[model samples]
Structures are given as C-alpha cells and as structure tokens.
Target chain A: MSTLKIEDYDRLRSKLPNRTGGWVPGTAVYCRGYDMMDDLVGRVDFFQSLVLNITGQLPEERFAKWLHAAHICVSWPDPRIWCNQIGAYAAMARATVNAASSFGNLAADSVMYGQGTLPIGTRLIQRLHTQHLNEKKSVEEIVDQEIERKGGKVNIMGFARPLASGDERVVAMRRTAKNLAYQDGAHMQLALAIEELLYNRYSETMNFTGYLCAFMSDLGYSAEQVHRIFALIVVNGVTASFSEEAEKPVDSFLPLRCEDIEYTGPAKRALPDMTDE
Target chain B: MVNRSVKSRKEPFVKKASTNIWQEQPVEHNPYLVEKTHLRGYDFDELTQHCDFTEMFYLLFLGELPNRNQKQLLQLLLVTFISPSPRHPASRSAMSLGGGKTFPQHILPASLGIAGGEYLGGRQVQLCMQLIQDNHQIIPALWLEEQEARLAEADKALLAEGRIIYGFGQQYGEIDPYASLLADKFLGKSFSGPHLTWCAGLVEELKPYCIGWLQTGIVAAVLCDLGFPPHAGAGLFQLIQAPGLLAHGLEAYPKSRTEFPFVRDEDYDIVDT
Candidate 1:
C-alpha cells in the first residue's frame, strides 16, 4: 500500500483548489460539492478507503461490508416528516438486514423514545387539544390553563398547538423519530447517513458526529435508522495513530502535510477524543 | 440534583392522568445516559481522551473517544462541512426572495431554506461566533441592536408591502417561555467581556421594539452570545428545530409489520374514468 506521509497529505490539501470560496479546504469541498467518491473511482468502498487513507488502518471485510450497507441505506432517504417521503425506507431496511447479518446483535433496542409511550402521549395531547377547543380556548390558553391546574413550571411554552389533528399517522411518526434520535449504534449510523445526505442536499458540510443526532432528527430521517447507522459508522470507521507528531502541524503550521507524519500503531483507538477536561 | 428536581416536577403530570397510559406508551430516552452496571469488563480507561469542544461533540454522538488521527480527520470533516457556502441552495433561496423587498415573507423562507440546506443546529452559534470575532465585549449589545434594527426594518418593509410581520404574534397564544431561559443560559453568565457590555446596550435599544414580543429580546441576546453571525441566524433557527424534526421522523418509522398498515390511508379514492 502506498503510505501517505504527512507532507503529502498537506501538499494535496493545500494544492486543492479552494472550491468552497473560503480559505478552508473542507469548506471548499463543501461549497463546490466535489464528490470524493467520484474523484477516487474504483474506490466505491470509499468508507473503507477513507478509514485506511486517513488513519492508516484497514477494516475487516465483513465490517467494511456492514459499514457500506449502513452508509448507503442511511444515505438514500432524506428525512421529511410532513411529506411522508419513503425513498430511504428501502435503504434502511437493507441496512438493518446487513447489520443483523454482520453483527450477532440484530434486535438491538432502538435508542429513540420508547415506542410504547408515544401513542399515549400524543393521544393525551390530542384530547387536551379537543378539550381546549370545546371550551372555546386557544391552544396556548389550554396549555397554560393545564400548566396552572397542574402547578407545573409552565416554563417551556407553545406545546399546545393542534398541528396534528390527532392523526394517528403523524403521532406515530413523531414518536419513532424521537426514539431514533436517542437510540445508540443505530443513531450513529443514522447521523452519519444524515451527514452525507445533508452534504449531498445542502452542499454544505459540518462536523460528522457532533451534530449527527441533531442532523438526523432535523432532516426528518427515521430516528431508529439514524441510531443504528451512527453506531455502525462509528464502529466501522475506528482507526489508530501510533505517532505523537499529529498535533505539531495543526497547532503551529499554516497547513498540514503528509511528510510530517510519524505515527505507527496497531493499537485500537476510538472514534471521538474525550479527555479534554 | 437537577434531575431529581425535574422528576419531582413531572410527578404531578404523571399522577393527574387517570390511568398509567403515559407509562404504557413508548418513551424516548437519552442514549448517553447508559447504565454503568451494564458496562461490565469494558476498559473505559483505555479510551482516548476527549479534550476540546469538537472532541466532546464527537464522543457525545459516537459514544467513544477518538485517537489523534481520527480526531484530526473529524476536525477536517467539520471544517469542510460546517462553513457556509456562497452558492448554497439556501443562499439561492434567499437571493430569489429578493433581499429586504419581501421582508418577513422573503426572509423567513430564505432563512429556513438556508438553515434546511446547511443542517445548522441554530443560527445563534453562528451569530455568537461572528460577534466574538468582531468585537468581544460589545457583541451582546451590538447583537441586540442589530437584531432589533433588522426586525424593525423587516417590519417596516412588510408594512410598506402591506404584509403582516412573520414570527411576531404568538401562534400558541403565549410567548415562548424558554427564550428567556435560553438567553440567560448562553449570555447571562458566560459573557463578561466588552461583548457583554455591547449586548446590554443593544438590549436597551431593542426593548422598545420588542413591545409584545419579549422572547425576541431573549432570542437576540442569547443568539448573540452563541456566536452566530447575522447572515447565519436563519440557519441557526433550522438547527434548533432539529429535535422537533427528528421526533417526527421517528414517529413515522414503521415499528413492526403491523405498524405498516397504519400508514395506508383509506380516505383517497381513484377515478378510473
């Protein structure tokens, strides 16, 4: 394998045209919508290559396949709740099957809000809405009255809108999305998928994991799929850097290069660095 | 302690319900709150360090610490992803709306389009970043003043065009209570430099304009502190609305084979003529 030195990485990044109209390399790609996959043809398994290229670590075939499936599935359908879009549903189903085949844990609990609680909550809220209308009270007035009656803080206002006329479909959708956002592994995959989707849709980029859940939920993707996809992406993308010279370029240099590389390790590493404090 | 307080407050709501319907219903849980006991034999000490906001952000979603290279890659990814694009679809949407001509109608869609396009969590962060970069201590004041001024300008433009103000009246009959709390959270404590003073001034200037919309004041103040730039405010709004969107998405997902049937609406009829 052609090892990429730190200097080489730096040179490539610096030489790349600033397509994003900003000084930042990443911003350039984001603004220009430069599809990385297209540039690296015959590398359809971009996720695997990305793991290797960026971290110098290769993933197992099974792991790579699972990751790819998750990626494609999560990436297919952009989340739109009110519109009831279903293009991504097939992808999600395929991802679930791939995950089950690759990982023994197929029936992992969804990270979203408990499926059991959503229906009742929505129904109850709907009932309250109806009661308010019956009493000739506005949605806000009813919520306030209820808060007062319940002696609650009433701090978070505007929860009494009758936006979903007790429609079982809408209620169910809301519940599933909420649950998916909170689900583990699945949430991760979903987040990654959304990240890709957003990049594709908006032609803007952002931190991958930081806003994964936020992005998935915001774009109207299936939260359950997001949770699962996030988990798979994080696990599949894991890599290690055996060198300590990583910080030298980013901190002091104007830009990083491949020649500056000096890390070597087979030691396993995680996806996020969590030792700041 | 905070959790306990919140739980105690919710007890009444739980009790008031005639039955345990709420408990029986599916409830979404925070994934981060993992059960310590379930993590047996896992060497958490071996995990990588999470040092900065970016690192913490990754851990929060990915559930594991990243190594040096991974961290760098993630950073590169973020820098590539988060920055605004000049020719973004949202920007196009905004441009098509005709700046200042349509006012709220134009601005809201444009902002939403920008936000939706970028997937930004909130415009507040972008605004805060801008203020901090421009003039630290005066950020708050400047933010308040600018927002109010923009709002007034928008309102005036709307009036001239014979259109009603957007996001002005309370749709739910009351102001958003969280607005003040959020403002205090973002700026009330963390801000102390020249930006803080500026924010105070802006608040004073804006108070008159926010006659009935008290929440606007809080939103402006908080967004200022959060580092969002004026152009990015609409994006921030979209970002904050992510949770709501996610909730809707999850609810729509089919839980089982049986749930799929619910998706079929029986109301529609096809004409074969």
Candidate 2:
C-alpha cells in the first residue's frame, strides 16, 4: 500500500511552488534572493545573472568574463556545423526567428556534441582527477582503462574531436584563462597530463569539451550545473546562420535537386490487390 | 602561435543520402523533378487507390499491410488515446502555446516534446518497453516481488514521492481508472499478443500495491505486440498522440490570452532558499 495520502497531491492542486524568485506586483522581483530590479539590473553582467539563476549563487566577475569568452569560442557563425545547419534550414523554410533559434538549440542537445556532452565529459574528468590524485593512479593507466571501457577504441569523450583532431578552441580558451589570471588547478593539470599522453601515443589531443570540463570542474561545478550553464551556448551561431538565410529567398539555403537524394529501395513494383477492403 | 593545427580527418561521408523507405523516380527530361514514387516497393498511386489509411500507415512502418486483426487493434488503440485529457500537461502546454499566440507550426513540436517527456509520456513508454523486453522471461509475480524488495531498500520518503516503475503506477495515489479500463479493452481484442497478455498478468500482480497499467504501459504493450523495437516506442507514442495535441492547440489558437488561467501571483508561493 502507498504511504502517500491524497491530500499530499491535493495541496498542490491550484498552487505553484517555486524555489526561485517571482514578481510581487507593486513591490519587486526576486531571483535567487537577489532583487532583480535593485541588485541585478544594470549591475551584473548577463553571464553572472545566468550563473546565479542556474547555480543559485552569483559568480565572480572574472568567472563571468571567462564564460563570455567560452561562449564566443563555441558560437562560430558557420552553418556547416549541425546545430547551425538546422537554423539555416529553419530560415529557408521561413520559420520565425525564435522558432529557428529554439529548434537549432534543441538539435544541439545531442550526444555527439554541444551541451549534451558536458555532463558526461564533466563526470569523466572529475572521476579521473580523483583516481589520479587521491588513488595515485598514473595517467597512462587511466588512459588505458578509459580506452578499454570504450571497447579498445580511442574514443574518450573529452579527449578527441570529431571532424579535426586538436581543438583550436582549447588553445584560444587557454590564452583567455591565462589573461584572466587563472592558474592550473589539479583537475586542469590532470587533463593536461592525459592530453600529453594521448597526443604522444595516439596522435589525438584534448578538445574544447576537455578544456571546459577541466576548467569548470576545478571551479567546483557539478556535471549537471555545467550542462545547464551551457544549454544555449550555440544560440548566437544559430541566430547568425538563421538571419543570413532568412534574408535571402525562400528555399535557397541549399537547394537540392530531386536526384540529390539516392533511393536504394526495390525497383518499381505493383501493389497487391487490397484484401482488407 | 597555437601549436595544434586543425586538419580534416577526411571521414568518408556519402555524397547523396540514401533511403530504403522511399524511392522517387526522376522525370526523364529534368532530373530535378520527380515523376513517380514507391514506398517499400508499393507504387504510390496503387496504394492510394486500393488501401485504407490504416493499411497504408501500417505498410509505411512495418513494411507490409497489417492483417485484419492487426488493423483493428491498431485502429482501436488510436481511437482509445485520440486525445489526452485536457488536464494533461501536454494538452495544457498546447493550449497555453495556442493562447499565447505562438507560431501555429511551433505548437505541435512544443506539445509533442512535453508528450515525449519522462512522466506519463513517450519516454516512460520507451522505458516500459525496455523493461518488458528485458524481463518478460521472469514470472510476473516474481518480478513484482523483486520490485517490492528494491523499493523497500529505497528511501521511503523518495518512494512515496512518486518513484514509479515506468509503465505501471498509481496516479493521484490511486490506480488510474481509465488506464485500467483501457487495459481490459485491449486485452479482450483478438490481436492482443503475448506481450500484452504478459503485461495484463503483471497488472494483476500489482493490484495489492495500488499500482496498475498506466497509459504509457498500454501503449508500450500494444507497440511491442505490433513488432516495434523498444527504441521506436517513444517516437511512436508521440506520433500516435500528435493529432490530439494539434487539435487542442488549434482549438485554442483563436482564443484570447486570458482564456487560459495564468495562476494569479497570490496562488504562487516562492520559498526562499
């Protein structure tokens, strides 16, 4: 028998319970205990406000600047990328800007890349950091174990890029972090060590996921928190692609000939007479 | 300078995407135009002339026309879940979107997303199908006993907070009456297969705990009987419920924004952290 009483659910029948803040008419709006109108508006940067909403704690200005750079690093205005391509297609079909942006953002919630990889990547780096520092495991052993876990494939989530190896974003972000006076924490050091080993042995290096996971993990963010923070990382790129295509003629993004689609199904055949009539 | 040079891995991608589900014959004069089409070997014109919508739909998915029993079962299932209740979150989302004057085309996708959620939706159906596929060999009563043991070890407060076993569970602290009735309706049909029968027996074992067939469970069982794999079950649930979602959305599309209740500020409580 369920211990739950009907009244437990009854209490919520006509009410909305929110931990986050809401607006009180004629008073003020609160967001995570900070008054939005008084404390946040025109005071904090967008990233600080975003981080506060996601993590329930306002981040430092330096961290917000670092995140701003990270956002720029990810949101390249190239429609050749999958999520941006969706935005281009949505524009070609004359979808509204919000529709194009939203649909493309949804597409980026993918296992192959973008925000979808953050949780897995963050968890992996955190776990490996613990093993290397606390458990005194060598970087070589950690790499071997991870590769073995992936069925002897060199397909660790953070360490490898999809199209091209060695991520340019990582180098750019490294420069950004240094300029912001951030030091290599233990997690970042462990990531660097793993990248060095992987590069020497397999000719593969850490990607942007690797760099972001390590940096965020060092700053004490959980996998879920990091994933939530970067949920709309590709929005700017998607919007840019959408605007360019939406400005042009309809269905002109990549007009495909009917012959462009290759059909390998059975040759022309007659349908059997319908017996179910 | 950054030492790493970004180079293409040169993965061999197909020049033209290929599809076995559809074949469109190009016009002789212009390859850019299509002259004929076939779906899984059945000519489009012939199918349109001879088959009913249900038959054509079955052929589209299962690659062949369904028999009379299969057709009847599928049609019955479709009508049974024609529209979720107005109180359902997906329906509410659709109504809300329509009331908000969102793009008419965006309504279906948004509502379908809610319908594909983990609670009482496509994700639950997918998980239930997986559970059935993975554990159908075990006796139903034994499986219930195992679940009972697992629940006993779990945090009591958490378990009481609606940690359901995918397809079978109580809604509002009681067995969902409509779900129970629908289960019986499907079980009485001629085309109900082993999967449905097995799930019915499981529902019997669940009665003592106030747990029974959920709508997702019924959908999962029927899709399993229809020979769809577990991964396809979620999308199938979304597709089956699309018409109802779209209907509710379109129905509210012309209504004023105030037509739907907006939960007054007094009704909303914000608890400080």
Candidate 3:
C-alpha cells in the first residue's frame, strides 16, 4: 500500500550485494592469539591489507611498492600546504593531536586543492580519454569544447597548477614510477597527449595531479576509490605538519601583528536601540 | 553515420550557490598568511578585537552585523542552546577519534557528520523549525490542535514504519531539564518574539502525547526569531557545537589507542529470533 513496496526491502539495504558470506565489520579488530587473527594480522602487511579491505583483493608486490612511492611523493610535511595547515592551527591552539589529525584529514577530503582534486582529475582523464578513443574525437576538439563549456578558464583537470612554473613532484613521481617499472597504460598515454596539446596552446604543464591521475588510473582504481585512498595516503603528512606546528606557543606558528591586516570595511558603528526588538 | 553525444547541463541558475552565509576567501595564495575571512567584508582583526562573538555570529548568518538587542539576544541563545555534552554522540565520536590520534583533519568534520543524523543534534531542530515556519502566522493554541489532528491521522502510518515524530518529547519519558531551563530564561527575556511564544504554547498541548518541548524546539524557535531559514538550523547547530567537539577531542589526546567499542562476537547471543 506504501510507495516502498515489500520487494524494495532488499534494494534499500546498504550491505554489498555480491558479498554473501562472512561478516566484515565497519571497523574490524584483530587480537593476537584470537580467532580470525591470522587472517588480518599475520598474513598481510598493512598496505596489502588496506588494498584487500578497500578493493577486495591484495595488489601484487610491485603495485604495492608503486603505491607506497606515490603516497610518499604527496606527503610533504609542510604546514604551509592547505590541508596540513588545519592540523598546524589545531596544534598551535593547544588542541588535541587527534583533533588536529582529524581536522587535517577532513581538509584533504573536502577542499578542492587536496584529495578532492584527485577524483576530479581521474574523472576528467577518463572522460577525455573515452571521448578521444571511443567517441573518435580529436584532442583539440575536446579541449576547445571543454574550455568553452567552463567559460574559457581551462577545464583540463590535471594540468596548469597555480603559482608555479612547474611542479617538481610530478618529475619525482614519474622517476619513482620508472624505478618501479610501472608501464604507462592507455590512460596515461592519452593524458600525455592532452598535456602536450595544452602546453602548446596554453603553456599548461602536467602538474602532480596529472601524474596522480595516471597512477591511480593505471592501478585500475575507480575515481571514488582514488579519492578515498588519496586522503588516506596523504593524511600522515598533514598529521606530521600538525605535530610540528603544535610544538609552538598558541597562535605563534606564523606570528601575525594586528596591523598586518588590511581593513577594507567601514569603521566600527555603534549598535542602536537596545532593550527592544 | 556517427552518433555524437551533445553536452548537457541544467539551465544556468546560480551555478555555485554556497549563499551569502559563508564563502571561501577568493585568494589563491597562502590563505593563512594574509586575512581570508570575509564576514561581510568586516575587518577580521578589528572584529575580533572590538566586537563580541555574537555580533560576528550575526554577520555569519545574516550577512550583516547585528543591533545591540539582536547581539545580546543571540548571545543568550548561544549560551542557552549550544551545549555539547560529553554524552552527545558527536562528542563521543570526537573523543574516540581523538583518543585514537586519528589525525587533526578528521576531528571536526567527522564529529559534525555524526551530529548531523536523523536523531540527536540535527533532525529535531530541523523538523521543529520547518513546522514552525510553515505555520508561521497561525494562532498557536489552535495550530497545536491542528498539528495533533494531522499527526493523529498519520501516526499509525508512521508507527508501522518505526518512525517517531521529531521536534517533541525526550528519549527519557520526562521532559529535558535543559529545555525547561532555557524556557525559563527565554520567558524572562524582554524581547519575546512571536515564534518563540508560538513554540512554547505548543508544549502543553503536546504533553498528553508523552511529548514535551525539547532544546531542539526552543533553539529552532529562537533561530526563526533571528530570521535564519529553517534549513540552516542543523548546519548552524553543528558549527556552534564544533568547539565542544574539539574540546572532547583534545581531552582524548593523551589516551592510548582506543577504538570506539565495537561489537565483539562473544558479546552477542545468537539465539534463534
């Protein structure tokens, strides 16, 4: 009789449909010498376990190593970086390390320049590549159309970072990828071609986002997974920055004089008519 | 023949609408290095130095600084309602996250996310605010009867689906003391807005149904008095409660790695249901 029919009960369930067997709790705990201990603790390393937990399969050793390198490349412990600054601010305010870590992690998850960019770039790369390969469109056509769509401000997600001639991180990540002998797949090749076209027209260099896009795509991770993993991987660096900054006096990390602020607003006006609405 | 997909978009109608309430500072550079907060372009330094937090809070919500009465009233409301008890689930989450040293970034957003659920810190206020707004100019006594009647028709439909009505009653059988204390204080205040009075009038009417006005109702009424949209209450409540979450998180900092109590297999008796 209701809009939600009896048959819809199974459809509304949050549980994974394919996994019909053992219970994988939201936060699984493993105790030494306890049942189901060896399955999580003794058999798999942390990264391997993380992959297994997220993707339902442990990646090969080479892929795990590559992932480790990719994690390290973004883990700059500079409190000056956007996401890390929250942690630093928390620390300086004499906030808890957990508070600092959690808030900093949140910064990566929400703000566009942090973990938000990874999924965005991944989606863009996949879309553009699909348009190029399957849709049989020229790179120029797609790039031009995208620029027009985004009001000509360059919608190419993985290139042309602000306030830099070029990122050194991309070079370092590529070097690490080479060291791991990680072959560039069709996605990466497509990204490189797009990058070349962008550079020729707009002087847009392939920033770390481009490399990250390629790396995540090569690992066969979906955009959402890439986003989550990006946050998980880079949070340690943000935590490090928070710990570093929290050592100083409250609000002392980058000491600011009151006069440094440019007051562009009106002078203080007195509030009128108290004791009545 | 080639089939090409054309680009599709919803007709351009405010592409990005975060609203006048809050916006990220447009500066692309190191935002913390210089001032980034634009509270209606209020000088952040001066605002902190001269104006009380209520004035700033008013600007945050209304996009304009408040008058003296508005400021003082808002301050009282904040004092009355913005209590983040340790027992609150959001605070509990913050404590757990902090205890585990999860990292600085996850604490506020994560805790606030916990706060923004169907029950607890969010939905009661949201529902109260909406009901109050929808029945804005109604005679409160009569309106209360109408509400009770309307729900009476739908009550069986709700109970069948395990849905308890929000904006009234307490988890415990009795009325919440916090709600009563704030109500006393609210009654004592000289500036009694119609919304506040309207919500107060509904309490007696609702009592026979094992429901009494909770903190969520009064807070919603006060916010409606202050001219915020009903929808903004939950998010604003979360924001106000953030410092309390931070405090809990900070308290948890020195503790050892303690995951929030997970259900152990042994703890549950798996007798046939």
What would the per-residue lDDT of candidate 3 be over residues A121-153, giving only the tens digit for each residue? 898888887888899989789878888988988
Instruction: Give the poorly placed runs of model 1, Cα more than 4 Å off.
Output: A1-277, B1-55, B58-153, B156-175, B187-201, B211-244, B252-273
Per-residue lDDT of candidate 3, residues B10-113 (tens digit): 34543232334432343456554434454556545556766667877787668677776677678888776565778788888999888888776677788887
**Residue B122 of candidate 3: its Cα lDDT?**
66
Model 1 chain B weakest 10-residue run by lDDT: B1-10
DockQ of all candidates, in order? 0.02, 0.57, 0.05
Best by lDDT: 2
Model 1 Cα shift for residue A15 (angstroms): 58
Candidate number achieving the greatest DockQ relative to the actual structure: 2
Write model 1 residue lDDT over B1-273, tens digit each, in one string.
Answer: 000001111222221213111111112363223222101112234322314655554443344444554455444334333323323344434433433233322333334434432122233334433544465445444555556555555644332211222222221223334433433443433233333345445434534444222232333333443333455444444544433333332333323435332212222222111
Which rank order by TM-score, best down to worst?
A: 2, 3, 1
lDDT of 2 by residue, B1-273 (tens): 124668889999888988777887789998767898889888898888988878888888888778888898888878888788888899999998898898899999999989987777898899889888888889999987888878667654333222356788777667889988888888966788888998999989877766778899999999888888999988889888989999999999999988877878899898889
lDDT of 2 at A190: 92
- Against the hidden true structure, what lDDT does model 2 obtain? 0.86
